[model samples]
Target: MRRVLLCLALFFASPLLANSKTLFLNGVYAATYGDIAWDKGDWRGSNFSAIRLKAGIQVVRIDFVSLTLGFQKVGFYSGMHKWSGDNDIGFDYRGPVLELHLFPDAPFGFSFAGATGTGYSYLTSASQYHYSSCEGCKIDAERSALKVGEFTAYVTYKISSQLEILAGAGTRSVKGEIDYDVDRGGVHSWEKGDVDSWKESNTMVLLGLRGSTL
Candidate 1:
């Protein structure tokens, strides 16, 4: 009986024994999906898709605004498939990322935030294209230096004093490369073709459940 009373006392006193800041950490399950159009060639319009794991930190007790910094690991899959024969090609892109956050109190006392970041991506695999009447072509190259950018907006709702639920949407742009081999037909001496600085952008939707103890 004495131990139960002592525990109750500690529970009541715990609120007064705490610090000022509320440190929050959350995991976001995100997916980016969108379409990309190309203007310089006879290629089909490309569509982009990506999956990422993102994390963030938020401070508490601030009235007007709060800040957050985030990190992500993104994996990308993209390609253009030709309609003739088996001339199909694709690229797998992987990367590490960093992000900035700006959270503000909106008109209804709700939280809204924006984010942007850079990512360094590496090309993981390349597949060769083969046609029925023409010789097969292979373009294998590994590239690890690419640029990334993002913009996000979110709404956060407090479930309790120590937990919150976040739902948001954002746009992400990642760079990649596509190489086309022009030597298969033997009609042109171009040998190889390069599509440098190729960019893919997608719209992302995410949900996060966070717990805080700061």
Candidate 2:
């Protein structure tokens, strides 16, 4: 986690950092569990959520549509795929993120975003840290990645020439590896679990404020 944050710090310090108005210190929180539809409408419950953070600078602005480019750190959670009181594997994401915002002069707006180029991290969890040294115990090595994308519609209120606040709700997609899909294999087979991957399309609700160009 520290390494990923350090990478983003360097990314923001590069030439891409400009004086123009942009969004910074942004986050979205959502809980995704239970019998949700995806994976051919299959159910896979393991208590996960789409918790993300990102910061970016405006790259293009035409009328009410603006595009931003910057680094994003995705996922902040203690939830797990196949968890035990002892430990479970965790995931992390860091990559170039792109976002588009559409806002009129009124109090309504919308935004869409996607992120990629992230690698799966097994280092953040204590479970992986302790057991990784043991032979043939590492998980999620083949298809290791956590992917996130979102679409949100919001109502905004301008706070100043350089700031605005928004409240919104929509859906976001998150993909990650599963040690054992609780819905498919059930918890009984957690002992001899098989590897699997899943993509979740879940609800999103957020309150955020951003700095817009002056």
Q: Give lDDT tens digits, candidate 1, residues 59-100.
A: 332455444443443433232223333223232323333332
What TM-score does candidate 1 reach?
0.44
Q: What lDDT does candidate 2 reach at residue 195?
A: 31
lDDT of 2 by residue, 1-214 (tens): 5754564455334323334333454522111100011111111233333334456665666788777675655443332233223333355556776677777244556666665645463422323221222233433322235665655555556765445576666665667654321222222222222435656676655565544441
Distance from true location, Cα of 44 in model 1, Å: 10
TM-score for each of the candidates: 0.44, 0.50
Question: Best-fitting candidate, measured by lDDT?
Answer: 2
Error of 2 at 62 (Å): 1.9
| Residue ranges of candidate 1 with Cα displaced over 4 Å | 1-51, 58-61, 76-137, 140-145, 177-192
Q: Give the deviation of candidate 2 from the true structure as CA RMSD.
A: 11.7
lDDT of 2: 0.45
Candidate 1 achieves a global lDDT of: 0.38
